[model samples]
Target: MNYLISALIITLIIPIWGLLIYFLNKLLYILLSKISSEKVAMTVVNYLTIPGVIHHELSHAALALLTGAIVTEFKPFWPDKTSGSLGHVNFSTRGSLFTRCLQCTFTSTAPVILGTLSSILLFAYAANNTVPFYILVPMIYLIFSIIIHASMSFADVKIMLKGIWALFIAAYIICLYFQIDFLNVIRLHLIAQL
Candidate 1:
Protein backbone atom coordinates (compact mmCIF):
# COMPACT_ATOMS: atom_id res chain seq x y z
CA MET A 1 0.00 0.00 0.00
CA ASN A 2 2.72 2.43 0.89
CA TYR A 3 4.69 1.38 -2.16
CA LEU A 4 1.64 1.99 -4.32
CA ILE A 5 1.26 5.48 -2.95
CA SER A 6 4.94 6.16 -3.41
CA ALA A 7 4.79 4.94 -7.00
CA LEU A 8 1.78 7.13 -7.71
CA ILE A 9 3.46 10.16 -6.21
CA ILE A 10 6.67 9.55 -8.11
CA THR A 11 4.84 9.10 -11.42
CA LEU A 12 2.66 12.17 -10.89
CA ILE A 13 5.19 14.67 -9.59
CA ILE A 14 7.31 15.04 -12.75
CA PRO A 15 4.31 15.51 -15.03
CA ILE A 16 2.81 18.11 -12.71
CA TRP A 17 6.14 19.93 -12.54
CA GLY A 18 6.39 19.81 -16.34
CA LEU A 19 2.90 21.24 -16.77
CA LEU A 20 3.63 24.01 -14.30
CA ILE A 21 6.81 24.92 -16.09
CA TYR A 22 5.04 24.83 -19.47
CA PHE A 23 2.41 27.32 -18.30
CA LEU A 24 4.97 29.51 -16.58
CA ASN A 25 7.09 29.57 -19.72
CA LYS A 26 4.08 30.51 -21.83
CA LEU A 27 3.27 33.37 -19.49
CA LEU A 28 6.87 34.55 -19.59
CA TYR A 29 6.83 34.39 -23.39
CA ILE A 30 3.69 36.52 -23.50
CA LEU A 31 5.16 39.00 -21.05
CA LEU A 32 8.30 39.23 -23.14
CA SER A 33 6.25 39.76 -26.31
CA LYS A 34 4.60 42.83 -24.81
CA ILE A 35 8.00 44.45 -24.39
CA SER A 36 9.25 43.70 -27.91
CA SER A 37 8.18 42.47 -31.30
CA GLU A 38 6.93 38.90 -31.39
CA LYS A 39 9.91 37.92 -33.50
CA VAL A 40 12.34 39.58 -31.15
CA ALA A 41 10.57 38.15 -28.14
CA MET A 42 10.68 34.65 -29.56
CA THR A 43 14.32 35.00 -30.48
CA VAL A 44 15.17 36.25 -27.04
CA VAL A 45 13.19 33.46 -25.44
CA ASN A 46 14.89 30.87 -27.61
CA TYR A 47 18.29 32.35 -26.88
CA LEU A 48 17.64 32.31 -23.17
CA THR A 49 16.49 28.70 -23.37
CA ILE A 50 19.25 27.45 -25.67
CA PRO A 51 20.72 25.22 -23.03
CA GLY A 52 17.39 23.57 -22.29
CA VAL A 53 16.56 23.24 -25.95
CA ILE A 54 19.82 21.44 -26.62
CA HIS A 55 19.35 19.18 -23.64
CA HIS A 56 15.74 18.40 -24.58
CA GLU A 57 16.53 17.46 -28.17
CA LEU A 58 19.73 15.59 -27.37
CA SER A 59 17.93 13.55 -24.76
CA HIS A 60 15.35 12.53 -27.33
CA ALA A 61 18.03 11.57 -29.81
CA ALA A 62 20.05 9.68 -27.28
CA LEU A 63 17.05 7.69 -26.09
CA ALA A 64 15.98 7.01 -29.65
CA LEU A 65 19.37 5.48 -30.39
CA LEU A 66 19.29 3.50 -27.19
CA THR A 67 15.89 2.08 -28.11
CA GLY A 68 17.17 1.11 -31.57
CA ALA A 69 15.03 3.74 -33.26
CA ILE A 70 16.62 5.38 -36.25
CA VAL A 71 16.79 9.09 -35.62
CA THR A 72 16.23 10.78 -38.98
CA GLU A 73 15.67 14.38 -38.00
CA PHE A 74 17.02 16.13 -34.94
CA LYS A 75 16.93 19.87 -34.58
CA PRO A 76 18.18 21.46 -31.42
CA PHE A 77 16.76 24.81 -32.48
CA TRP A 78 14.96 24.97 -35.77
CA PRO A 79 12.85 27.96 -36.72
CA ASP A 80 10.20 26.00 -38.54
CA LYS A 81 7.40 27.99 -40.13
CA THR A 82 4.53 25.62 -39.41
CA SER A 83 5.53 23.43 -36.47
CA GLY A 84 5.86 25.30 -33.20
CA SER A 85 8.49 22.84 -32.01
CA LEU A 86 11.45 24.85 -30.79
CA GLY A 87 13.40 21.60 -30.90
CA HIS A 88 12.44 18.14 -32.08
CA VAL A 89 13.51 14.60 -32.82
CA ASN A 90 12.03 12.61 -35.67
CA PHE A 91 12.77 8.93 -35.21
CA SER A 92 11.58 5.71 -36.77
CA THR A 93 8.83 3.97 -34.79
CA ARG A 94 9.67 0.40 -35.58
CA GLY A 95 9.45 -1.64 -32.42
CA SER A 96 7.04 -3.50 -30.20
CA LEU A 97 4.22 -1.24 -29.11
CA PHE A 98 5.28 -1.49 -25.49
CA THR A 99 8.89 -0.69 -26.22
CA ARG A 100 8.04 2.14 -28.60
CA CYS A 101 5.56 3.69 -26.22
CA LEU A 102 7.81 3.40 -23.20
CA GLN A 103 10.73 4.84 -25.14
CA CYS A 104 8.60 7.71 -26.35
CA THR A 105 7.46 8.41 -22.82
CA PHE A 106 11.01 8.35 -21.52
CA THR A 107 12.26 10.49 -24.41
CA SER A 108 9.57 13.07 -23.83
CA THR A 109 10.17 13.19 -20.09
CA ALA A 110 13.97 13.02 -20.23
CA PRO A 111 14.53 16.73 -19.72
CA VAL A 112 12.87 16.76 -16.33
CA ILE A 113 14.79 13.70 -15.22
CA LEU A 114 18.13 14.87 -16.53
CA GLY A 115 17.68 18.51 -15.55
CA THR A 116 16.65 17.73 -11.99
CA LEU A 117 19.55 15.33 -11.62
CA SER A 118 21.95 17.88 -13.04
CA SER A 119 20.66 20.61 -10.76
CA ILE A 120 20.87 18.42 -7.67
CA LEU A 121 24.34 17.22 -8.52
CA LEU A 122 25.55 20.74 -9.19
CA PHE A 123 24.08 21.95 -5.93
CA ALA A 124 25.63 19.09 -4.03
CA TYR A 125 29.00 19.69 -5.63
CA ALA A 126 28.82 23.38 -4.91
CA ALA A 127 27.91 22.70 -1.32
CA ASN A 128 30.64 20.14 -0.90
CA ASN A 129 33.31 22.28 -2.47
CA THR A 130 34.35 25.89 -2.06
CA VAL A 131 33.58 27.46 -5.43
CA PRO A 132 34.39 31.01 -6.60
CA PHE A 133 31.59 33.62 -6.86
CA TYR A 134 31.84 34.02 -10.64
CA ILE A 135 31.68 30.27 -11.22
CA LEU A 136 28.90 29.88 -8.70
CA VAL A 137 26.67 32.52 -10.31
CA PRO A 138 26.85 30.94 -13.77
CA MET A 139 26.29 27.51 -12.28
CA ILE A 140 23.19 28.80 -10.52
CA TYR A 141 21.93 30.41 -13.72
CA LEU A 142 22.51 27.18 -15.64
CA ILE A 143 20.65 25.16 -13.04
CA PHE A 144 17.64 27.50 -13.11
CA SER A 145 17.71 27.56 -16.90
CA ILE A 146 17.58 23.77 -16.97
CA ILE A 147 14.70 23.69 -14.47
CA ILE A 148 12.66 26.36 -16.26
CA HIS A 149 13.18 24.70 -19.62
CA ALA A 150 12.71 21.11 -18.50
CA SER A 151 9.15 20.84 -19.77
CA MET A 152 7.73 18.98 -22.73
CA SER A 153 5.28 20.60 -25.12
CA PHE A 154 1.68 19.39 -25.27
CA ALA A 155 2.40 17.32 -28.36
CA ASP A 156 5.19 15.47 -26.61
CA VAL A 157 2.94 14.69 -23.66
CA LYS A 158 0.13 13.61 -25.96
CA ILE A 159 2.35 11.04 -27.62
CA MET A 160 3.44 9.64 -24.27
CA LEU A 161 -0.03 9.69 -22.72
CA LYS A 162 -1.32 7.48 -25.52
CA GLY A 163 0.26 4.54 -23.71
CA ILE A 164 0.34 6.09 -20.26
CA TRP A 165 -2.18 3.61 -18.91
CA ALA A 166 -0.08 0.69 -20.01
CA LEU A 167 2.95 2.21 -18.35
CA PHE A 168 1.00 2.76 -15.15
CA ILE A 169 -0.22 -0.83 -15.12
CA ALA A 170 3.27 -2.11 -15.68
CA ALA A 171 4.55 0.05 -12.86
CA TYR A 172 1.82 -1.15 -10.53
CA ILE A 173 2.53 -4.78 -11.29
CA ILE A 174 6.25 -4.31 -10.81
CA CYS A 175 5.86 -2.50 -7.53
CA LEU A 176 3.05 -4.62 -6.13
CA TYR A 177 4.54 -7.96 -7.03
CA PHE A 178 8.09 -7.04 -6.17
CA GLN A 179 7.24 -4.93 -3.11
CA ILE A 180 9.75 -2.44 -4.36
CA ASP A 181 9.47 1.24 -3.69
CA PHE A 182 11.27 2.31 -6.81
CA LEU A 183 11.04 5.99 -6.02
CA ASN A 184 12.45 5.56 -2.55
CA VAL A 185 15.31 3.49 -3.90
CA ILE A 186 16.07 6.14 -6.52
CA ARG A 187 15.83 8.96 -4.00
CA LEU A 188 18.06 7.22 -1.51
CA HIS A 189 20.68 5.94 -3.91
CA LEU A 190 20.81 8.71 -6.54
CA ILE A 191 20.32 11.73 -4.29
CA ALA A 192 22.17 10.47 -1.25
CA GLN A 193 25.16 9.29 -3.22
CA LEU A 194 25.65 12.85 -4.36
Candidate 2:
Protein backbone atom coordinates (compact mmCIF):
# COMPACT_ATOMS: atom_id res chain seq x y z
CA MET A 1 0.00 0.00 0.00
CA ASN A 2 2.82 2.37 0.82
CA TYR A 3 4.47 1.48 -2.44
CA LEU A 4 1.23 2.24 -4.25
CA ILE A 5 0.91 5.74 -2.71
CA SER A 6 4.55 6.52 -3.35
CA ALA A 7 4.24 5.44 -6.94
CA LEU A 8 1.07 7.45 -7.36
CA ILE A 9 2.63 10.60 -5.96
CA ILE A 10 5.73 10.17 -8.05
CA THR A 11 3.65 9.77 -11.13
CA LEU A 12 1.51 12.78 -10.31
CA ILE A 13 4.36 15.09 -9.31
CA ILE A 14 6.37 14.88 -12.53
CA PRO A 15 3.33 15.26 -14.74
CA ILE A 16 2.27 18.30 -12.75
CA TRP A 17 5.70 19.77 -13.25
CA GLY A 18 5.33 19.04 -16.93
CA LEU A 19 2.03 20.88 -16.96
CA LEU A 20 3.58 23.97 -15.40
CA ILE A 21 6.46 23.94 -17.83
CA TYR A 22 4.10 23.72 -20.75
CA PHE A 23 2.10 26.80 -19.78
CA LEU A 24 5.26 28.66 -18.82
CA ASN A 25 6.87 28.07 -22.19
CA LYS A 26 3.81 29.31 -23.99
CA LEU A 27 3.72 32.44 -21.85
CA LEU A 28 7.35 33.20 -22.64
CA TYR A 29 6.95 32.61 -26.35
CA ILE A 30 4.11 35.06 -26.52
CA LEU A 31 5.73 37.86 -24.56
CA LEU A 32 9.51 38.08 -24.91
CA SER A 33 9.96 37.28 -28.58
CA LYS A 34 10.17 39.00 -31.91
CA ILE A 35 11.54 38.51 -35.40
CA SER A 36 15.14 39.60 -35.69
CA SER A 37 18.26 38.87 -37.64
CA GLU A 38 20.42 35.99 -36.50
CA LYS A 39 22.84 38.38 -34.86
CA VAL A 40 20.18 40.24 -32.94
CA ALA A 41 18.35 37.09 -31.93
CA MET A 42 21.52 35.57 -30.56
CA THR A 43 22.27 38.70 -28.58
CA VAL A 44 18.83 38.79 -27.03
CA VAL A 45 18.54 35.06 -26.39
CA ASN A 46 21.43 35.01 -23.95
CA TYR A 47 20.13 37.43 -21.37
CA LEU A 48 16.59 38.56 -22.14
CA THR A 49 15.33 35.34 -23.61
CA ILE A 50 12.00 34.89 -21.86
CA PRO A 51 10.12 33.97 -18.70
CA GLY A 52 11.35 30.39 -18.94
CA VAL A 53 14.62 30.88 -17.04
CA ILE A 54 12.54 31.86 -14.03
CA HIS A 55 10.97 28.45 -14.21
CA HIS A 56 14.37 26.82 -14.42
CA GLU A 57 15.92 28.68 -11.53
CA LEU A 58 12.86 28.33 -9.31
CA SER A 59 12.85 24.61 -9.94
CA HIS A 60 16.43 24.41 -8.72
CA ALA A 61 15.76 26.43 -5.58
CA ALA A 62 12.63 24.46 -4.82
CA LEU A 63 14.33 21.12 -5.22
CA ALA A 64 17.19 22.22 -3.00
CA LEU A 65 14.84 23.40 -0.29
CA LEU A 66 13.02 20.10 -0.53
CA THR A 67 16.23 18.17 0.03
CA GLY A 68 17.16 20.28 3.07
CA ALA A 69 19.45 22.69 1.20
CA ILE A 70 19.18 26.23 2.48
CA VAL A 71 17.86 28.61 -0.17
CA THR A 72 17.53 32.28 0.55
CA GLU A 73 15.67 33.51 -2.55
CA PHE A 74 15.38 33.45 -6.34
CA LYS A 75 14.21 35.73 -9.14
CA PRO A 76 13.05 35.41 -12.73
CA PHE A 77 14.35 36.98 -15.93
CA TRP A 78 12.19 39.37 -17.86
CA PRO A 79 12.58 42.10 -20.46
CA ASP A 80 14.23 45.15 -18.93
CA LYS A 81 11.15 47.11 -19.98
CA THR A 82 14.01 49.24 -21.24
CA SER A 83 15.54 46.72 -23.66
CA GLY A 84 16.28 43.11 -24.13
CA SER A 85 19.76 41.58 -23.49
CA LEU A 86 19.56 41.99 -19.74
CA GLY A 87 19.13 38.80 -17.74
CA HIS A 88 18.75 40.34 -14.33
CA VAL A 89 17.55 38.17 -11.48
CA ASN A 90 18.02 37.86 -7.70
CA PHE A 91 18.90 34.64 -5.88
CA SER A 92 20.92 33.42 -2.92
CA THR A 93 21.76 30.20 -1.09
CA ARG A 94 23.19 28.97 2.18
CA GLY A 95 23.94 25.28 1.89
CA SER A 96 26.88 22.92 2.18
CA LEU A 97 29.14 22.57 -0.85
CA PHE A 98 27.70 19.21 -1.81
CA THR A 99 24.13 20.32 -1.36
CA ARG A 100 24.95 23.52 -3.17
CA CYS A 101 26.41 21.57 -6.06
CA LEU A 102 23.27 19.56 -6.30
CA GLN A 103 21.27 22.77 -6.13
CA CYS A 104 23.46 24.32 -8.80
CA THR A 105 22.99 21.44 -11.15
CA PHE A 106 19.26 21.58 -10.56
CA THR A 107 19.03 25.32 -11.08
CA SER A 108 21.40 25.47 -14.06
CA THR A 109 20.10 22.50 -15.97
CA ALA A 110 16.40 22.62 -15.11
CA PRO A 111 15.37 24.63 -18.16
CA VAL A 112 17.46 22.70 -20.60
CA ILE A 113 17.36 19.16 -19.20
CA LEU A 114 14.59 18.96 -16.60
CA GLY A 115 12.46 21.28 -18.65
CA THR A 116 12.96 18.77 -21.41
CA LEU A 117 12.49 15.90 -19.03
CA SER A 118 9.30 17.45 -17.69
CA SER A 119 7.95 17.49 -21.20
CA ILE A 120 8.91 13.92 -21.75
CA LEU A 121 7.27 12.90 -18.51
CA LEU A 122 4.07 14.63 -19.53
CA PHE A 123 4.03 12.95 -22.89
CA ALA A 124 4.54 9.64 -21.15
CA TYR A 125 1.61 10.34 -18.86
CA ALA A 126 -0.53 11.36 -21.79
CA ALA A 127 0.10 7.90 -23.10
CA ASN A 128 -1.42 6.41 -19.94
CA ASN A 129 -3.08 9.05 -17.75
CA THR A 130 -6.75 9.91 -17.97
CA VAL A 131 -6.15 13.66 -17.70
CA PRO A 132 -4.86 14.75 -21.09
CA PHE A 133 -4.03 18.11 -19.53
CA TYR A 134 -1.30 16.22 -17.71
CA ILE A 135 0.59 15.80 -20.94
CA LEU A 136 -0.50 18.82 -22.95
CA VAL A 137 0.71 21.52 -20.56
CA PRO A 138 4.34 20.39 -20.31
CA MET A 139 4.61 19.57 -24.00
CA ILE A 140 3.90 23.20 -24.71
CA TYR A 141 6.51 24.41 -22.22
CA LEU A 142 9.15 22.09 -23.62
CA ILE A 143 8.56 23.32 -27.15
CA PHE A 144 8.57 26.99 -26.23
CA SER A 145 11.69 26.76 -24.06
CA ILE A 146 13.54 24.77 -26.72
CA ILE A 147 12.73 27.49 -29.21
CA ILE A 148 13.57 30.42 -26.92
CA HIS A 149 16.86 28.91 -25.76
CA ALA A 150 17.77 27.82 -29.27
CA SER A 151 20.33 29.85 -31.14
CA MET A 152 18.69 31.82 -33.80
CA SER A 153 20.85 32.38 -36.90
CA PHE A 154 21.45 35.65 -35.06
CA ALA A 155 23.44 33.84 -32.35
CA ASP A 156 26.11 31.18 -32.47
CA VAL A 157 25.84 27.97 -30.45
CA LYS A 158 29.47 28.18 -29.29
CA ILE A 159 28.86 31.46 -27.53
CA MET A 160 25.63 30.22 -25.99
CA LEU A 161 27.29 27.07 -24.66
CA LYS A 162 29.97 29.14 -22.98
CA GLY A 163 27.31 31.26 -21.27
CA ILE A 164 25.56 28.11 -20.06
CA TRP A 165 28.74 26.76 -18.47
CA ALA A 166 29.36 30.08 -16.84
CA LEU A 167 25.85 30.11 -15.42
CA PHE A 168 26.34 26.59 -14.05
CA ILE A 169 29.51 27.57 -12.24
CA ALA A 170 27.86 30.71 -10.95
CA ALA A 171 24.99 28.71 -9.54
CA TYR A 172 27.41 26.66 -7.45
CA ILE A 173 29.21 29.68 -6.07
CA ILE A 174 25.93 31.44 -5.40
CA CYS A 175 24.73 28.46 -3.39
CA LEU A 176 27.91 28.52 -1.35
CA TYR A 177 27.58 32.16 -0.37
CA PHE A 178 24.21 33.53 0.61
CA GLN A 179 25.07 37.06 -0.43
CA ILE A 180 26.93 36.50 -3.71
CA ASP A 181 24.93 38.00 -6.52
CA PHE A 182 25.05 37.24 -10.23
CA LEU A 183 22.20 39.55 -11.17
CA ASN A 184 24.00 42.65 -10.03
CA VAL A 185 27.19 41.41 -11.64
CA ILE A 186 25.41 40.92 -14.94
CA ARG A 187 23.78 44.33 -14.75
CA LEU A 188 27.09 46.02 -13.97
CA HIS A 189 28.85 44.29 -16.85
CA LEU A 190 26.12 45.28 -19.23
CA ILE A 191 26.26 48.86 -18.03
CA ALA A 192 30.01 48.86 -18.64
CA GLN A 193 29.49 47.56 -22.18
CA LEU A 194 27.08 50.36 -22.88
Query: Best candidate, TM-score-wise?
Result: 1
What is candidate 1's lDDT per residue for 1-194, written digit by digit as tens?
A: 66777667656776777788788878878988898878877876677768777877777788778867788999887756687667788877668888777677766676767777877898999999999999999888777677667787787688668656556666777778888776667788998889
Q: Which candidate is the best by lDDT?
A: 1
Query: Distance from true position, residue 135, model 1, in Å?
Result: 1.9
Candidate 1: 10-residue stretch with minimal lDDT: 162-171
Off by over 4 Å in 2: 1-51, 81-90, 127-142, 146-194
Candidate 2 worst ten-residue window by lDDT: 150-159
Against the true structure, candidate 1 reaches a TM-score of 0.78
